[model samples]
Target: MTTYLKDLTQSIGYLEAQVVSLLGAKNLASMRGKGKLNMLYDP
Candidate 1:
């Protein structure tokens, strides 16, 4: 279970990075402000 969670977290981080690169920081911040982001992945 620990390994699974670690892999999942890593995957989520990678995906989030991709989204940030595609959307840019300003767009990401706007989405966060609108409460569109999940709290677990806030960082």
Candidate 2:
């Protein structure tokens, strides 16, 4: 029972990290897209 609980906790932490990184990647992509649009309009 104790080992199972430990494993569950670790799994949750790993999942949280994955979600954070995925969100970061999405934000980066959106920012890059906006930058490209700005460049297109500015020049």
Candidate 3:
């Protein structure tokens, strides 16, 4: 059970990184560096 919990956390982190990279790539590709990917998170 402990191993399962650890794996779950790791998987969630990996998934979030993949999603963020994909979104950031698209944004960066379109803007060509006019804005930052982190801006998506900031208000």
Candidate 4:
């Protein structure tokens, strides 16, 4: 039972890392567009 719990925790951690990586990629794309817009307006 303890080993099962440990395996479950590791699986959850792996899923969380995948979610974070996906979000980071999306955020980077959004930020790149926003940065260009800001430069255009602020310059």
Candidate 5:
């Protein structure tokens, strides 16, 4: 029972990290686009 709990916790942690990494990459891409737009519009 204890080993199973440990495995479950580890799996959950791994999933959380993957989600965070994916979100970070998506946000970075969005920011990159905004930066390009700013450069194009600046006088």
Candidate 6:
């Protein structure tokens, strides 16, 4: 029972980290896209 609980907690932590990283990556991608747009539009 204790071992199972530990594994469950570990899995949840890993999932949370994965989600955070994915969000960060998406934000970074959008930022890069905006930079590209600025470069194209700016005089």
Q: Please rank every candidate by TM-score, starting with the best.
A: 4, 5, 2, 6, 3, 1
* Candidate 1 lDDT over residue span 1-43, tens digit each: 9999999999999999998798887767776787854655666
lDDT of 2: 0.86
- Model 6 segments beyond 4 Å from truth? 36-43
* Candidate 6 worst ten-residue window by lDDT: 34-43
lDDT of 3 by residue, 1-43 (tens): 9999999999999999999999989877776665676667656
lDDT of 4 by residue, 1-43 (tens): 9999999999999999999999989877887878876545553
For all candidates in order, the CA lDDT equals 0.82, 0.86, 0.85, 0.86, 0.87, 0.87
For model 2, how many clashes? Answer: 0
Model 2, stretches more than 4 Å misplaced? 36-43
Winning candidate number (TM-score): 4
RMSD of every candidate to native, in Å, equals 9.8, 6.2, 5.1, 5.0, 5.9, 6.4
TM-scores, each model vs. reference? 0.55, 0.67, 0.65, 0.78, 0.77, 0.66
Tens digits of per-residue lDDT for model 6 on 1-43?
Answer: 9999999999999999999999989877877878876656555
Better of 4 and 6 by lDDT: 6
The alpha-carbon deviation from the true structure for residue 42 of candidate 3, after best TM-score superposition, in angstroms, is 9.8
Where does candidate 3 clash, by residue pair?
Answer: none
Report the lDDT tens digits of candidate 2 across residue range 1-43. Answer: 9999999999999999999999989877877878876645553
Clashes of each: 0, 0, 0, 0, 0, 0
Report the lDDT of model 5 for residue 5: 100
Pairs that collide in candidate 1 are: none
Superposed by TM-score, candidate 6 places the C-alpha of residue 14 at a distance from the truth, in angstroms, of 0.9
